[model samples]
Target: MTTPGWWAMALCEAVNDKTPLAVAFAGEELVLFRNAEGQAFALEDRCPHRRVPLALGRVVAAGLQCGYHGWTFDGASGRCTQIPNLRTNEPVPPRYAARAFPVSEGNGFVHVWLGEGVPDIDLPTDDYRPVGQQFTGSTIVNMSHEQYLAAMLDGPECLLNFAHVRMTDFFLGDVRKEHGRLVLERGAVWTTQILPSNFVVDYPLIVRTEVPVQGGSIRVDLLSEDETPLISLAIASGANRRGTTSLCWRGFVHAEVPAKAPLRWRTARVWHKAPFTVNSLIDGSAVAALLEAPSRDLHAARPPRLIPVSAVV
Candidate 1:
């Protein structure tokens, strides 16, 4: 189940020059590390000899050194640079190498290219632009990647929450395609607002969700009734071991606050606390109760990943 695109594997800060970070995405195990010059790289976790995980190795001046047999591999090319106990006359075999993937870093994430050739599109985080102090977190949810995505659309409320805001069932509009993603919007209101016995006139807030058509990168926004942005989040998700899904997110509260916001919301902003949270524990019952809404269009309209011609070259 390999998805051909730039998948956010880990937070950029999590991968450093001192240690190798192991991550699994789309069922591919990869070891991430930085070179002496601080350039990030990713390689197949298994070493060619003994099949030991390269992640167990250490970062050396030359490159990543295998823990078992002292085999060193170059970060850029994943070619074995040196072998222990080799005579000066004997050269390292050019064929000895680990599978390497292209790496890109931006918007607080380390993205790895999982396609056949050069990346033909912008990175999943290209549109991410955080304003103030950003809150971030990482976790593995006990759900399959496909199901996780389905739940994101079917019931985002079950997966995450916005402080002082209550998401409503009223759909703003039908799901639509926008810039290679499926976008949905729903009505929302302040948690402190009292509902009238009769039907309310209009919602005071809005919750917008944008999910990519192919990859697992998702963007969520909380906006005022007039579409003023209040909070924005970027969530990177992918498959992990044992039918679980890996998730990492970065988000921030906007400077502008709604006039109708509660005192707690105002205090949270002044104290610089995160205005939203990505749930580490999902509710199974809530997920089961959610009707398959916009996700139906998402699954049906999603196109297959196409290998660009450059990959063959």
Candidate 2:
């Protein structure tokens, strides 16, 4: 499966001098390590010989060494440099190299390019600081990657559905049954304003970036109310036998609920080919925009001119 857009794989601090870090993103297991010079490198976690996880080994002056046979690989090039047990005259095969990935660090996060060919856009360094309290957690949801994205883009409308109201009320504190206005903008960014019936000055503005992943999954950066990083989520299907969605929260200000729990939704209700209402055009159009150009050159594509529409509940 081909993944579209740049993915924020891990926080910059995830890789340090002590040891290599292993991470799974877009169905690929990668190991991140810092060389002796403190430069970061990402390589396929498996060692070609004996298939031992390289992450389990120590970071040597040469590169990452396999724990099984003490074979060392070049951190940047992924080329095998040494085999401890090889004969004095024996030559290492040319194919003994691990797959390497392009990595960049900025904005307190590490970004990995998972797509084929060259990266068209630089790693995003946009600020996403939280305005209030921050909370971070991960949860597993029973749904496909596409199904998970559909549920997220469905937004508050899905929360107001008769089948979902009981659950929504628990999280949102009796939000009025209303439709929010969605505005799609350039650079694949969009915003939604949700006004609840009870709160006069508490309308929440949700801003989201659509970062598509392989296997129809998505990684999104979400902000609520003026650059407040509410959630940075990586949504994928079958990450385990059950689908998994990992999230980090910042500036989440729901006073009624002291701590947020993993919220589950029936995928069958959220996954639909047709937009339930005109307001849902954002979801369909967002998917269309992603499909139109699966290349890394999405930012250079023509800007979509969509007329903002209001959907009444």
Each model's TM-score?
0.93, 0.54
lDDT of 2: 0.46
lDDT of 1 by residue, 192-283 (tens): 77774125677888899988788778899999988999999999988888989899999988888888778988998999887898998999
Highest lDDT among the candidates is held by which one?
A: 1
Each prediction's RMSD to truth: 2.6, 13.6
Candidate 2 weakest ten by summed lDDT: 304-313
C-alpha positional error of residue 53 in candidate 2 after TM-score superposition, expressed in Å: 2.2
How well does candidate 1 match the true structure in TM-score terms?
A: 0.93
**Residue-wise C-alpha lDDT for candidate 2, range 112-229, written one tens digit per residue:** 5565656545443343433334332233333433334434443423311111221111122211111111112111111121334344343233324343322222333434335444
Candidate 1 all-Cα RMSD: 2.6
